[model samples]
Target: MADYHSPTVIQPTIPSADMTALERLILGHIFDTEADGDGLYLFAEIGPSDSFELPVRDLRRAIAASADTESTVNAYISERIAALTDDDTHVEIDLSGMSWEFILQDIVRRSPTLDHVTAISAFTCTRMRPDGFGGMAVVITADAIRGKSTNDIVEDFLGDDAHDALYAGTHVLLRVREHAVKEQIAEAIGADPDLTSINPDAVTESDIRSACLDVVACSDLSEEQGAAEFRAAVAAIRAAERRDQAPG
Candidate 1:
């Protein structure tokens, strides 16, 4: 088995076909002036229906804008859609769990109308993608910090996204342990130097509890509260891990 808990990156993409017209317009507007915007175009009619490049800054803006109500966005798109004669126009924006924390902080700095709470809420929605098992998963890369001013990243996640959960439930992708936690866990569990170190399937509750202790030692949580919160986080990680390890 691979590192059952190592951070694995999965780049998510919204294909042109999957994107709403509003989403496409928002991206097109952002990428219009850039010369190296992959295939991104100012006009959807002229752009390819399959793929287009989304610059990091523009992608951040799009995620911020998406937090608005669906009707508000649709209204914006409706106003712009009249310019396109083709009904089949589409676009795709590729995204990953990486750099979202920095982008959220940037959004807070540049957009005065958006505060930390709103920006963080938007981040939750953008990081979420279908877990392919009728659920949604929030992709929190190893480097992505949960909260700007708070140490309890996992605990804050229990909060909803822009709207509601919008799926069966949401899980944080914590399979990849933080480097600090990784070293501690390896020593505590007596696992291999290589992070794939342990069999996820074989890990016991005692092992998970021990690992969770290392993760939240400095947290403000009392021992009992910390244990519960870490357990929730581990449960979510295990759920995603099971999906990944499921037999085809």
Candidate 2:
């Protein structure tokens, strides 16, 4: 077999210095698979194979190597699309519509894939690195390549399906923040008797702190005044933190 990484006098091969330049050639096809507005790219990347094993990590590395020609790269992408969606049961891939949410999910779920980021536009993936913390760390520098999740135009263009997975994470976060705020406010009131007298949590301790939650926002809907109390308590607690942090 001829070596593409090194050329003999008769057959010219890509030099090590220009390896990055070689990576740029297939970048268009990579991004195009995503931009085509179908889920083929993600499904192919993370979906299970015949034995239900995911080989996307290795598959991507092989395709991204300097030794791969453009035609072979295109064939690989095509084969992946077919392999992932061959069965009628896998129809969901086609319905997904090029979602960034799906892409991030695949990145987060897969174990072995490594992400290589570049000052080169995020849409253009370069050489594959052998190491990373995991998939999430791989894309830490890849915010620019974001699809419908971060791109306003793509989100709008893709409509409701695009926001589905993105907002699912957001919903979980809102719940966590609400729980944290309520707990913080309750701790403050319990610790301070003087503050307990305030039925409204929104009341200012000395005049600082933003409203966090009302009692009405919690399980005690009957305690209308509890809302004010909760807010005021939260404010007082934060105000205390600010005072401590202030310079003498």
Candidate 3:
């Protein structure tokens, strides 16, 4: 056989899992994954593979050298998506309409080949939600790409969902603020003798806090504002009671 000439122009191949991990890291940093209004949230610089294997730094360096890292990451995503099997079991979620938790469970149940790790890593949310406004993506850090718990991933996604709802100025904020006010007022009532003694037997602290929260929850106010209003309401009620007990 003639002398074999090694090709110098060819690039060394890395495992597809490693490529997926790095691509996810790059994409996560490029988009608004957490709905924080920050497009570039750098959770991790060098995400590790599922096996905890380190990627070839040179491959990362080459991508960084590219003029548009976004395009480079997209190309990698496309390549991976193309390699996916044509199995009918594979499922991707449209977070715009469906619940992430439900879809995640469905993905696992439907796709026998997908364990928790692969299911999470291969899920559409791991990259982007096609139906989201501007295709809102999820933050797939090294831990997530390396196979974090499904519950953790789902929880994070739910948190992102909440953030998105808040960022969009939806009713979710109102409900969350109201719930917080109720808890804060409950805690205050528990700690303050004055609040507890206002109507100990006749009216439960729970009832009082609920009534106060009703007024506080009318407007979308900060927890501090709500708490302040709640305190003031309790004080007024206390003052009125004291006047009624005063000798005529």
Candidate 4:
């Protein structure tokens, strides 16, 4: 159990040996400037590849200009292959999901020609929104807002580092609770203040719901919505009840 789910939840990587012949070729282009890219170059040269129809430059530019390091390039390639196929044998960029961000970011910076814009448009998500959001914030990705006006707004609200803002807002790295809610939950759970102060596991759902009502009493958030959203915000910690991320 952990307060925040680690990046390992999705693994986020496909080993070089596991990649299809064409995928290995695209991966080599991403790390073209890296000294360690030599290994991948050899793999691409030795390949007898299958048919692949991709906007080769768009995908390549996405990786070359992306903020991610070499490792993430591999992960992006993995995600691309997984998205396009039911089984593991195929590898192709479906031009879907956040994968479009790579090409879109590049397009916005350059001329947004008809063909270029058409290539990455109409992307969709295959998964549900994470419960960590609590509807308090929307997952506004960098590509979703790619103009001068949008940049200014995002800089003001989320600060200049839009990628970092997207990461922080979506992930549940910490939990926030009002002091009143803390004390009320402690009393309801009947646990020693010192033992349970840092972790509030024993508190029943009724107690949590009651404490949330106390929070709503002091705020404009509707009693029902406030309690539910508050619970959602702290869902990670509640699931891992006694887990503390701090190093001993």
Candidate 5:
């Protein structure tokens, strides 16, 4: 189990062919790039099917014309990754229970032959206060942050050779966690509900209530308001069942 962080960026080596199609798709999206000026080029690649190649002269021109080139590029990558989706996708990786070092080490271990890896960076888990629903957020940065401002650093790394690959991989990892949480919640309730599943590793106070509601709705044991009383009753029954099975 890894300590849950808000977001952490990792640079995974190219994985073997054993990875799922979705994983391959993400990896393909990442490592796409083209040579540009002075040994600089657009570094992001989404998949084998998606990529961008910019000439050095063109890159310089674009940066010169924009007041915030790095900001622009970072925003582009963020938007692009957010838009990615697959039909009936359901998988998630939860970092809340895993340590950062272990997670990174696992990634590296999983792809021992990959050589393009450069750097992996991440932000510590930060508490975010939403108007009504507050939770912790993990921030991940895969490329080097070189500029003075965060925006500049983003841009510089977005321009790295591995930017796209890093973005796609990180995005996939996030989705994996989301799906895993949903799955756990569904299993807990013995019924699939409309709300997304709660990542057990990062379960919030709200998640507990949400799960309780689902359990009440699905259990065969009650029919009233399905309030705390019902929950306690059902929980007690479950506890007794477990206790009965203990290896005595």
Candidate 6:
């Protein structure tokens, strides 16, 4: 073997507060893995003197450097994505149910292996309703070439049989808001309080009167008043639907 010499490079000292613990850890990992004999040098001289320096040898360093500033973080993550292994994986912490477009856009902007992404999936609890509290979790795994479209990849993963297994036994709860009288009538008639698919055509005035009388008997409402109210409610609903169907 001939003589081997690593390149000589100057490492800049960065302030501690500017970088997060996770960012520093990622940088150190990348530096140890990818840096040549001469450690990477951070380019921070153009900004204010108080700005921190970050020399990245690998993805970790790049991530740390970007975490120091908001605008540069995207660039840093993009570079790191390029430097990451073909098998790089990512996890998204989403407790706010952000739109898929936003999530994927951010991921693509920061990831080098965007095309190689093989699988993406969500993991979350039923309590974290995507429609309500906007809580969700996402993870992505990629192949070596990073050659797939994010939308297609995410759709396929979601469509997979394995993905469905995760949501097994999870009951979705839907809230229905109605007048207290309507709810009582539904309960008395053995109809679901939340059911909105009742066909008015399939029912008659007699049905409404009967339901109302039952509700009144079961509750505090006077039977005569309840029957009158039920008739009025049915007429109102029918009128509204007719108005909706009529041309504006």
Reference-based TM-score of each model: 0.19, 0.20, 0.15, 0.19, 0.17, 0.16
For model 6, residues 1-248, the per-residue Cα lDDT tens digits are 22222111112322334344444443343222233333323221111121223333443554555565443234434543565455555422221222222322343344443421122222223353443221122333221112244455667887886757988854433223234445555565566545656643345434556666675466643576668678978999999999999997
Select the stronger candidate by TM-score from 1 and 2: 2
How many clashes in candidate 1?
5
Clashing pairs in 3: none
Cα displacement (Å) at residue 98, model 1: 20
Q: How would you encode candidate 1's per-residue C-alpha lDDT over 43-105 as one tens digit per residue? A: 222221223443444434454565453433344334433343434344243223223334323
- In model 2, what lDDT does residue 67 have? 39
Error of 6 at 236 (Å): 99
lDDT of 3 at 149: 45
Q: Write the per-residue lDDT of candidate 4 for residues 1-248, one digit (tens) a residue.
A: 21321110101122334333433455443222122332222122222123344554445444454434334334655565434433334335433333423422333233222222221111112344343211111122223432233334556666647767667756443333556565766575565545444546445444666666775576653576667778886996676765665456
Question: In model 4, what lDDT does residue 139 have?
Answer: 20
Q: Relative to the true structure, how large is the alpha-carbon lDDT of every model? A: 0.39, 0.36, 0.39, 0.39, 0.38, 0.40
Off by over 4 Å in 1: 1-24, 30-33, 37-178, 184-248
Colliding pairs, model 1 = 3-196, 5-175, 6-176, 7-176, 16-91
State in Å the error of residue 26, model 1.
Answer: 3.0
Candidate 2 vs 5: which has more lDDT = 5
Per TM-score, the best of the predicted structures is 2
Per-residue lDDT for 17 in model 2? 31
lDDT score of residue 248 within candidate 3: 100
Output the lDDT of residue 209, model 5: 55
Runs of candidate 2 with Cα error greater than 4 angstroms are: 1-28, 32-96, 111-218, 224-248
